[model samples]
Target: MGSNIVFSANNNEEVMVLPVVPEIEVNKPQNNEQFETLNNGTINLIGDEGLRTFSIASIFPSQKYSWLKHGSVAEPFKYVDFFNKWRAKKVPLRVVTSRPDGREWFNMPCVIDSFTFKQLRNGDIEYTLDMAEYRFIGGV
Candidate 1:
């Protein structure tokens, strides 16, 4: 079974591994339904399924440090630029998640719906990413 979870983003040629592991929350697609009463007391249903959403919360240190996975140092200030670029580009990213039971979930062609940053009293920074699966009209 896999133990640790890793997150990586492809800004260009380099795939930066997020230093900290965040809690991933996945909400499955919900069914949308509406019922119309008939004269016989039976109901007719009409509706479709909704889209899924994902949210991740983690802390990004405001200091330069090396990540053991990539063995590369990352500066906190650079993350601001990264997030800004990703938000502005409106491109789909591949997000891979590994579970503890040797199971991996891959979410591709996803875009960042929202990105938020907060500063704590301890001088630490926290980032929350809200994403949604992108369904292409043609194909991804």
Candidate 2:
């Protein structure tokens, strides 16, 4: 099986396959609350679920190596450029995680909450990306 993680903003016209499988951190907290009732009893309420967030910390390679998981090799700067342009556009980017046979486990449109990267001495770009699920607003 090849890489199962992919990122795209161009409707799959183009995509970037993660060079390695990152240990993703998934979080979606509930807003449960408790309040005091007039009768001196506590009332517990189960609030709506918060947006699910996905965190990824990995390295974008500058050169192809033995462990490279993706099929093609791209300069690290290209990855950075993609993120910069997408964030500037303020549009939801899509991440699709699926099985080798194409059974998807995660397919979400998310806003880029944060993106940070550092160039290491070896020319690899180490990056931390945080994305939050986007909830659609009313449509005309």
lDDT of 2: 0.83
State the local distance difference test value for candidate 1.
Answer: 0.62
Which lDDT tens digits does candidate 1 get at residues 3-116? 233434553443445656566777877575556566656554545655678987876665554532243234554555666676677666656666657577664556788889
Clashing pairs for predicted structure model 2, backbone only: none
Model 1 TM-score (2 dp): 0.71
- TM-scores of the candidates in the order shown: 0.71, 0.86
| Segments of candidate 1 deviating more than 4 angstroms | 1-14, 39-49, 63-73, 119-123
How do the residues 52-133 of candidate 2 rate in per-residue lDDT, one tens digit apiece?
9989999989888888775545488888888888889886788988766668878887888899999999999999999999
Per-residue error at 45 for model 1, in Å?
Answer: 4.5
Highest TM-score against the true fold, candidate: 2
How well does candidate 1 match the true structure, expressed as C-alpha RMSD?
Answer: 3.7
